[model samples]
Target chain A: MVKTYVFGHKSPDSDSITSSLVMTNLEKELGNTEVQAYRLGNINKETEFILNYLDIDAPELLENIEDDANVILVDHNSPSESVENLENANILKVVDHHKLALKTSYPLFLRFEPVGCTETILCKLYEENNVEITKEMATLMLSAIISDTLLLKSPTTTEDDKKAVTKLSKIAEIDVEEYGLKMLKAGTDLSSFSIEEILALDAKQIDFKNVKSIVNQVNTASIPDVLEMKDELEEGMNKIIEKENLDLFMLLITDIVNSNSQVIALGKNADLVEKSYDIKLEDNMVLLEGVVSRKKQVVPIMTENA
Target chain B: MVKTYVFGHKSPDSDSITSSLVMTNLEKELGNTEVQAYRLGNINKETEFILNYLDIDAPELLENIEDDANVILVDHNSPSESVENLENANILKVVDHHKLALKTSYPLFLRFEPVGCTETILCKLYEENNVEITKEMATLMLSAIISDTLLLKSPTTTEDDKKAVTKLSKIAEIDVEEYGLKMLKAGTDLSSFSIEEILALDAKQIDFKNVKSIVNQVNTASIPDVLEMKDELEEGMNKIIEKENLDLFMLLITDIVNSNSQVIALGKNADLVEKSYDIKLEDNMVLLEGVVSRKKQVVPIMTENA
Candidate 1:
């Protein structure tokens, strides 16, 4: 029997990684024994921290899928965010929490909500299917909600997400405040990564009308410390902009502790960022107060202004 | 406050017409008082029978939507199938039971399942939200499910649809077999329709790889009577093919009583239909035994062969 490969988007965040594992578990509980969890990209620090804390092994990396492969997507649905040759794969199901950008030739099961995290929707799925949420599953669910919503501080946090975090934390027997802060701080450690690697983390390519740009984000305890390497980061961003022929590139150094972001704008259309947030750039950088979510705050605003 | 418009695809079917009204009711129950249901095209005979039987008004026809208008789409999501300027509208939600083909700039609520009818998913929504199904709503829901599933005999019918029909029939206070047969027969009255009207009733444009085709279906009690007008129907089909630059045009004359379809294939790539179903086209037509569903039986098979 052929196995169904379940995975998230290319850059596997905590929500993406956790949703894949949770959906695989839910599918197995529903008697689909041939389902297996995989990750399209390397696990990020936040997701790796959660996996290590729960003593769960990370899903194997999926380089590419063959034609007619049975695939289930979680957290993201856009073909650009998924694995290569995704259009040829037989997508059986998609559980996502992002703006829709998918096209399929046949009818399939899709569950999408305007929630902060994909695991929050997966939590409801478990309750709807009458499957017991195990401690490990609860922990994974709680961790993803924390990572995506910035401990319920981001603007993207919905009522469903808040309720799921409360319920799953209780099931996991963990203190929400204490564990969430530690896990978030664990991901803020950028000492081991090079400037290029930091720039690559959580980078999303977006088209704003005619202007093409890449919006990359990194969570840190101190935005000033990340800005210390602004010269080198700008060099790295310039290399990417030239290679991809992007009109603009914006790097958001998000202060997870304070729930703000210090953005460094580069490329030809960098002034659009200044126009969007109504903040003039000082040396191509500006502090965006209370702007933590790239999806909610940065992308929409820039797309509107552009 | 501006009212949000809820509607379904153009050339509205029973499922599309019923879903828009049901979704509007669901939104009102959820405290969204500014939502109104509309229809993109004229209601069919089957939906007209349902509305008249229940003493309900058909939704007003919507010519077009303005820029940034709030919209909730039911039964369909593709832009081509929806109203004009759909890309300029703020799509708030979608309740559909078809293959996914939508792209949006923001995250929104989407509920899609692989059931026979969109009403089957709406039945689940009413239960999930603790909204009581009134007798009128139940009748409308039951009517759509019956029409889409061909009285629960279509291959697209799922277990959820079967259960919804049973539960809704009790609330609707109607006999399923007796009322369903009448409603199906009411739609089969083709005496009032011209050959062009019959061909345009449920015509769906599909792209099978590079082959562009239009597959149309019309229900009837007698296929022999419909075949008598094949010469005129072929003329109309040929005109549409030339005007639209189509590769093929297939007209499925479905016998609702016998659950069989007599298909008339025409145009340049009409041989593709014979190749797909492994039947020789006698007079560019063949009997498709036990094939009543265009979505489940015809589209997928032709797509695979194309």
Candidate 2:
């Protein structure tokens, strides 16, 4: 039997990284032993914190897929968000919690739900298959839900996510409020990252109509501290815009405590940001009040306005 | 709340029509009262037989959807296979057993599995949500499974489909061999259909590497009887090919009992038929031994060769 590789979307986050691992475990429990978990990119600080706390190793980094390699995608389905040369790979299954954009030539196993995190759906899969959820797996699942839903505060959080978090937290035997805040704050510490690294932390490439753009978001307790690096961030964003020939680039610095975001918009179609939110961009930046989710609060609005 | 319409693909067959109705019932049981089922086209003979046997009415025909109509898709998801003006509609959910080609701007509920029929997955949904399946729904689901899987003999049939068939047959209080054979034979009775009607019975428009084509399949008990109308069928196919500016058109006349197909090739790239199967097209047709599934056996082979 040919081995199958499992991984998540590029610019790996807590949910993406953890879902890949959980899915791999589920597949193995279902008697598919020829599968291994991989990460599409480097793990962020929040994911690193959880892995260290649980004493779990990070999945190996995957740079490129061999031709006709069998792959199982978690957390995302679009080719744009996946690994390089994904078109050549044979996608055997997809477990995601995002909008549908993937196209395939054959029928495959796909499980998608409008929930906050991919782990929430994976938690259901574990139950449905009657597989035992170990402490490490429960911790991973709980942490991912907490990260994606921002401790059940984001608009994308659904009842399924809330239930999964409750069940997983009890099994993992962790204080949700205490541990969630520490992990989130650890990710917010950007002093060790360069301007480019910070920009690449959670950037997503999206095409709205013909306007190509990249939306990068970073969560912090104090938005003002991240905004202090406005000039350096703009230089890095412009460099990426020029290299990729993008129409727009938005950097959303979100305050996890207040649930608001300060955005820096740049590029030729930067006015689309102002048009979408009906707000003015002061010094190439604006405060989007009560906006935290890029998927719920940003992408759809930009797509409509574009 | 605005009413949401549920439907399947055009050229509605047993699985397509039955899945729409079953999904509507499942939604209603889940507390979604403002939902109704509709069929994209006229129900075929096999589905009509099942509906009449169960003393149920067929769903109303859906011609075109209004702008921004909320809809739930069943059995099929590709835009070309769905209703007109689908791009302007808001798709809330999809329950399918086909390839993933549908793209949405927002995250929604999608459940796709590699099964023989969409009803097989719908059966799991009913059990998962603890919804009771009435006798009518069970009969409809069982008939769809039998039709799509050819009484569990098709290569597309999976273990879940086999299990569903056994369970549903007991609930409906029907004999598997008796009712399945009757339904399968009812669909194969294509003598009442015209050459054009036979061609339109189950036509699917596909684009393979810019080679636009339509692949139509019709099941029959006697291949020679259908072959007697070869001249008229070829003329009608030519007219459609010219009108649609197609590169290829293939008509697969399958014998349900023998599990083989006789294909009629037409259009500019008709030689693709020979290229795909590595066989000569004698009199613009060839016998495809053991080819019963358009999805599993035909489309994938054509795609790889294209």
Per TM-score, the best of the predicted structures is: 2
Regions more than 4 Å wrong, model 2: none
RMSD of every candidate to native, in Å, equals: 1.8, 1.0
Chain A TM-score of prediction number 1:
0.98
Flag regions of model 1 displaced more than 4 Å. Answer: none
Docking class of 1: high
Q: For candidate 1, lDDT tens digit of each residue in B209-258?
A: 88999999899999998888999999999999999999999999999999
| lDDT value, candidate 2, whole model | 0.93
**Candidate 1 positional error at B163, Å:** 2.0
Q: DockQ for each candidate?
A: 0.84, 0.90
lDDT of 2 by residue, B1-306 (tens): 899999999999999999999999999999889999999987888888899898899999999999999999999999999999999999999999999899999998899999999999999999888899888899999999999998899999999999999999999999998998888888877777787788888999988777899999988888998898999999999999989899999999989889999999999888888898999999899999999999999888888888
Q: What TM-score does the predicted chain A of each candidate obtain versus native chain A?
A: 0.98, 0.99
Report the C-alpha lDDT of model 1 over A133-164, residue by residue, as the tens digit. Answer: 99999999999999999999999999999999
Clashes of each: 0, 0
